[model samples]
Structure formats: C-alpha cells, structure tokens
Target: MDLPNTEAVGAIVALLLARTKRGDGMKPWVRLVVPLCIAVAWVHSPALAQQPAKDPRIGFLWSGVAEAAAVRMNAFLEGVRGALRAQGDHIELVARIADGNQARLPTLAAELVAGKVDVLFAAGPAAVRAARAASPSVPIVALDLETDPIEAGLIAGLSHPGGNLTGVFFDFPDFGAKWLQLLRDAAPKLSRLAVFWDPSTGPMQLKAVEAVAGSMDVHLSVIEVIDVGNIEEAFRTAAKQKVDGLLVLSSPIFGSSPAMIADLALRDRLPAIMLFPEFAQTGGLLAYGPNLIDLFRQSGTMTGKVLAGTAPADLPVERPARFQLIVNLRTARTLGLDIPPSLLIRADQVIE
Candidate 1:
C-alpha cells in the first residue's frame, strides 16, 4: 500500500487539530459555516469588478443635403471615428437631417437632448442656433457656418464662444472676395452679374456678395429667392434679365437645387460659378471654394480634442486652409466659354 509522506500527513493532522480546537471553543456548526461563508464571498467578488462604465454619446445636426454639407458630414464622421480609435473612447452619434428647414431645428435639437447625448455637433448657423436654444449646459461644436456665431447668438464671442459651443467658423463673410474673383476668371466680359440669394437665411451671405461685388465694380443684381417653390421663378428672372453671367450663393436653398441650377445655366448658355465642386460635376461652368471635406475633418479634430478632455473654448476656431478651383470642361464647352490656360493650370480638377 502506498503511504502518504510524513510532512504532508503532519500538515493535514495539524489542520484537523486546529479545526477540532475551534469547534471545541465554539459550536461544530459555526466552525463548519465559516469556510462556506468565505467561499461564497470569494465567488461574488468578480461581479463587483464587472460593473459597467459610462460611454459618451455625440449628437449631429445638418441644415440640408447640399453637396458641401454631405461632403463635410462624411469627412467629419471619418475623423470622429479615427479620433475615437486613437483615444480608446467609444462614442455614439445621434444625427438629424433638417433639409434647410431652420424651423424644424428646434424639434430636432430637443430630440437629441432628450436622448441624453453627451455633446452635440451642429453643422451650420441654423443648427447651432437650435442647439444653443435647446441646452445651455451640453457642449456643442459648430462647423463651416456662414454666419457669425456671436451674431447668431450661438456664442458670446469667437475667442470664448462663451459657453458650451465652439468649433470651426468658415467666416462666410470672407467668401465675397473669392466668389467675385472666380466669376471674373470664368466670364471676363461678364458685365451684368446677377446674385440669387434668400432674404431670410442669406442676409449674411448677401453681405459677403455685396462687399466683394462693390469692390470688384461689377453690376450686382440681387434676386431674392425666399419661397423654395419660387426658386424656378428666380432663375427665370435671372435668365430674363440678360445678365452676362450668374453667380450663386452657398446657401442651403441654392445648394438643394444644384442640378436644376446647372441645367438652367447650361440651357441659357450662361457661364456660372458654383460654390461647391459637385456643382461643376453637375454641369456648372466652374467651382472655386474651400474643400468642404477638409473643413469637416477639421471639425472632427476639435471633437476628438474635446473628447480627450481639452476644453472646446480653449480651441481657437479654425479657418479653411485648403481651397480648390475646379473647372468643368464639358460645361465650359457647352457654354462656349474659353477657359484661359493660366486659370486651368491653377485649377485642382479640370473635368472633361
């Protein structure tokens, strides 16, 4: 018969002796119950360690489906994902598409807040305004807007954005210079220039148009397109006015009708300048503006920084660093406009 080692046997006897002494000092049942209690507590310890931690949710709102807005949204989201990966943070986005109806923004903002999003990202002036009105405590990052944040009451000032709202400001007021230069390049003899804008949402944009138009010494005709249904009438008026060329503003109302506007300009054989490159793709003669996608990606950088614990207010509003000039050769040929070699060389994309 195999026998246990003397050392092991002695250890076992010692443990039994200790237990016997404890049982004698108390009751046998109490001695037996102590080990069971210790085992139960040890089994439950893991449940405490597995308690869930909080995850952050982000909210996004857009004014409309203009090509610029779409591109910017995509770029921003791509950046958001990249930033989250680098920071090891999990984020959920609550998004709403308002389609240029500023009036609908309040309801959308309310819904995001009700969903308890940790923060919000507003794309334009209308979205920023709605978000600001919805919650004063939740942080917001507004991107590529045409209006002054302070003027729109979205912030107290640019340096402080003075509340929970902060992000890139495209300084729409500066586009006046770029728009006029692009117009002159596309249509050298374009004596009469007609600007189509909305009086309600485009006053700030109009100010930009007027400032540059005045400086450029071009004949500026402002045709106000307020009702969305009356956009065709506005285009018809531009065509009837015998304007040498038409310059479109970067407004949601104008952007939503890009294909129609391109068709109108093409049908009329009028050289037109588009605010977004996709307009040139849709047949506008030329497009010269900031690469909206870059602006959006920049916004994502700010969002990532905020998520990483940097204060939004401490981050300065970024300006557009990269701009593009895209000329559509097909549209140019159809409009019978000869694009100068110099301008063509400067263009980022020359579409044939």
Candidate 2:
C-alpha cells in the first residue's frame, strides 16, 4: 500500500494548531502543543491515513417545553434539526427545565460551556442570556426570545447582532397590539380586562399589556404571579374584581402551565384570550400571534448558516413575517357568545 505524504500531514496539522491556539487564547504551554501535534501528524500519517475527521459537535440548550410540554417548542427543535441535517452537522440537545426556577440557569450554562460545543442553540430569552454569559466565542442562535435584543444588549440591532449571537426575535411588542386587538374583537363588550403574568418570566408581556390597555377602552387589571404558587391567588383577585375578560400574557410560565390555566379559565367560565393557539385550543377562547413552528424553522435556517462557516453576527436577526389567529369554537359555545362569521373567516384556524 502506498503511504500518505507525511509532509502534507505535518502542514495540515500545523495550520490547524495555529488556528486553534489563536481562537482559544491558549497559554504558552498549551501553545507548544502545536509543534508537538505537527511532529505526531508526520509520524502517524501511515497508520491514520484513512481516518475520518470527527464531525463538529453542536449543542442545544432548551428552556420552556422543547423537552417536556411537547408544544410548539418541539416543533422548533425539529425544524432546527432539519435545517442542520441538511448541512451535514451533528447536533446534541441538553435540556434544563427550570420549571420556573430562575436560579438554576447559571449552573446549566456552565455545563454546556464545559462541554466545549462548537455552536449553541439557546431556546428562549433565559436560555439565551445564560448561554451568552457562559460562552463568549462560540456561535449562538437564539430561538423564541421575546425581548428587544438591542435593548437587552443581546445584539447591536435587528440588522446586525455585532457579536457571536444572532437569530430570530419574536417581536413581542408588535404581537402585544395584535393580542389586545384579538381580545377586543372576541369580546366587544369587554369592560375590564385582567392581565396575568409571571414577573420573572414576562417582562415583555407586561410592557405590551400596559402600552395598549388604554387604547382598547378596557380597564386594565395587572395581575402578577411571581411563582407557581401564586397563580391561584392571582386568579382569585381577577375573579373578585369582576373582570369581564382575561388576557393571559405570553411567557415561559404561561407556556409551561397551559393546561392548568386553560382548565381553570373554563371552570371559572371566564372569557379568556391568549397568545398561542395551543393555549386557546386547550380551553381558552382565542389566541392571536405568530406561528411558533415557523419561527423555529427560521431558527433552523440561521443554524445552517453558522454551521456553513458564516459568523452568527453576519446573519441578521429576523422578525417573524407571518402571524396566526385561532379561535376555539367549543370555548365560544361554552361562553354563550356568537363569534362573528367575518372573524371566523379571518382566523388561520378555527377549532371546532
């Protein structure tokens, strides 16, 4: 058998070592390994001539329901996987369910960074913030984050992330207007609207609620539930105030407790509008917002670009171009209200 060229192997190894050292900011002792690696490459070429290069390892750090709830989060993960598979990259997922535990994030971030993943998928704002804190150089694609990336200093702007982070923004503020409009249209006689949110998880939700509450001519009742234990108390207050309609703010907490909240609303016979279709389908009256599956698929597109050697900063942050409005006819019927035919026609989906 003809042996591979040792000189060529040495040259390739040396080139790789230089790039690695520069990128990793290695100390002198570690830097000395470059020469040693090249020497070994020259000597080992004959035996390792046909060895396949190890595929790059990518990591996914998911918050919310990508690992559990089996909602739109799962769709986003599948979409991201499909995109990376098209580009021939190997990916692995590490999920941490804070389950509303904000304190666990730093530890979770440490674990992913310790694994030395080539790239990362940060699934929500909390996960993204954690990943950013953990790794400064590794490329990150953020999915479903509901903050203004610029204001949060996650990116320089929508058009330029200007760092190792970039992906799609959920544009929560714009959706706030749409969500309020959906609420008003669903219950035209809505007098007082109670807004429910988890302060730890729903900053954008609260801001949006305040911004449009006045224009809709409905008295806004800001109900905050900082922990899982406070949810019932928050609802009791809403009920006592005789809130005509309830608008559940979009948040990781709401996403986590969709079934429970939906059931409570149905049992209480409250006319509720939400921001996700799955929430409305479970028992809430309606939902109006972007399709999370499509957003996740778009996140996959960004992952593909990063794996293809494009910098995360080079890929501009994307705003969802499409949105969806869904109404649950069963919930409408239970509430003893007739949904206008025009509204039904405008719905992307009407769950009967």
Worst 10 residues of 1 by lDDT: 29-38
Error of 1 at 311 (Å): 2.3
On residues 33-94, what C-alpha lDDT tens digit does candidate 1 reach at each position? 00101111123344454333455777777666433344555577567756665443345555
Clash pairs, model 2 backbone: none
Give per-residue CA lDDT, model 2, range 109-223, as digits (tens). 6776787766787766777888899989989998754677887888887777889999888756766667777777777898898888756554776787678878778788889
lDDT of each model, Cα atoms only? 0.69, 0.68
Cα-based RMSD of candidate 2: 10.0
Q: Model 2: which ten-residue window has the lowest total lDDT? A: 27-36
List where candidate 1 sits over 4 angstroms from the true fold.
1-49, 66-72, 87-89, 150-160, 172-174, 200-202, 212-217, 226-230
Choose the strongest candidate by TM-score: 2
Model 2 residue runs over 4 Å out of place are: 1-49, 65-77, 85-89, 201-203, 227-229
